[model samples]
Target chain A: MSRRPEPVQVVKERRDAALDTLVGGLPYLAFLGIRFERRGDELTAVLPFRDENIGNPLLPALHGGVTAAFLETAAVVELAWSQLWPQMEGGAGAAAPGVRPPLPRTIDFTVDFLRSGLPRDAYARAVVVRQGRRYASVRVEGWQDNRARLFAQASGHFMMPDLSAGPGAAFADDEAMDPAPPASEPR
Target chain B: MSDDQYLRIAQQFIEALPHARVLGLRLLSVSPGHAEIELPWAAHLVGDPATGVLHGGAVSTLMDTCGGAAVMAHPAANAGAATLDLRIDYMRAATPGQAVRARAECLRVTRSVAFVRATASDDDVERPVALMQGAFTLHAPRLAGEAT
Candidate 1:
């Protein structure tokens, strides 16, 4: 008889692979050089410092929108991970065909700028405040050197896509459905 | 500040932002209490590969920068301001292969804060891709050539 892998190990591998797929699908995240590190089930979103991220050369601060975007991305990814966890756990071996859940859509996002984002690597973590079948609320906090002194904080509401319908089903009629030729160069 | 001064300041402000340059954000127009910026479509700005739509983050950045420009252009505001809080609502994803433009107006300026309202749209003018409202800290007015 062939040896079988432990259930915990299988779940861990699936979690990592799912996360790669989730984050890899976003071109803007790749453009901004934002990456994720998973420690157990927790995720820390990192925005590596780049000259292009600066808004004010004098103050040498990161762009406010970039900060907000980082927070929002963190929230969205966290919410998606929370939704993915249970499904991955339940269907360990019986993989559901054509059941990739679509990304959650942002309804509204509110960001509070506490301090200027310095020209350094920034980090963010998001917590899902509440997630229902159709809607989710997430709160994210971003910091540079010190987590206690957050540079920015954000709360956002997202419209959860119907997981039963599978990927692309929810956005088929919209402009997002049409796929264009791949760009030759990365912008 | 005079209209010309405001225009010059707005131009200089947008030019000084490195991220704005990276995103190729253009200052289309600026006047007292009003400013307009445009972001051309680029392959790098696409948020979703499946749909070829520009990222909501890119739109957020454009609107935020536009709001700050409007605040700076306001007669009551000074040379520099910082965003205190900003709220953005995604109306819809922007059309692919088209440029997005954001218009912002400084609705009210208090002693220490400036209020701004902004909207972003693509080719379709009737429906906006996103709407933004923000509060910005107002610095004391300074001379054109004054050092920071």
Candidate 2:
């Protein structure tokens, strides 16, 4: 993958503004208190725990569904901010300072859970392993210990549309998306 | 003779399932030994071009639901079992706008857990869009009804 032309340095004002716009409409992560922090080459998202986020009542650990959602959200958001991919609804200008015009869709994902994330804020960082105009793959690491102890992780394959006809800056006009519904099993 | 008492709960169970509400999966039918779920088209939920085909994640969830229900119908004491591992292989894409259906068989269900295999298809069950196999733990006691 010829490194897609590196983007210009995202200035503070521009960066924060873009992030705020991108993060606002995501109902799922918002409910979980997921927030983003960007340094060079790396993107981070945090999940601040809530009482209702627990399922097993006994262990008081973050529910598995919540953990998986955190991992998926972080991976997709990382793709958005990293410029390797764009948010499904967001484009180059409003979400990331220098991201390319069109966004990539998550194609495939695999997640592994190492430890239960107890009730508290959980931190995650994602890195782009390979990137191309057509497809981009990323790996996301989520941790509760603050140092990457392998609490949860996921990797996804994504595809994007051609900018000439795809959803453009006008995407900003739509409201933020609600958190996607839970997994619907057969039965 | 009760032909299929578990049939009603089978369908209702999917509706009451918290995750199903969260994912937007709709229940189509739940009969004596069969069930089906539908995933309406949503760009974010799709993986391949089957624009209307159910998202792979949605398909996985449906498969689990079917497996869980199979265990629940078996007269097992425990009706709870967490998915330890789930694996799916995507074959073909469902038609855009058409709803995909999954038919699963309770291949083998034991006292501690059950194993199931399912196939997803657009128009033909023989020609499946995807195939899934999974194991579900029967958390309920050893008795739900007759052992399967």
Model 2 collision count:
23
Residue A30 of model 2 has an lDDT of 52
Candidate 2 accuracy as lDDT: 0.56
lDDT of 1 by residue, A38-127 (tens): 987799999999999998787678999999999988998898778777777665521353333567878899999988888899999999
Score candidate 1 by TM-score against the native. 0.87
TM-score of chain B of 1: 0.88
Could you report the Cα RMSD, in angstroms, for every candidate shown? Answer: 6.2, 10.2
Q: Compute DockQ for each candidate against the true complex.
A: 0.46, 0.07
Each model's lDDT comes to: 0.84, 0.56
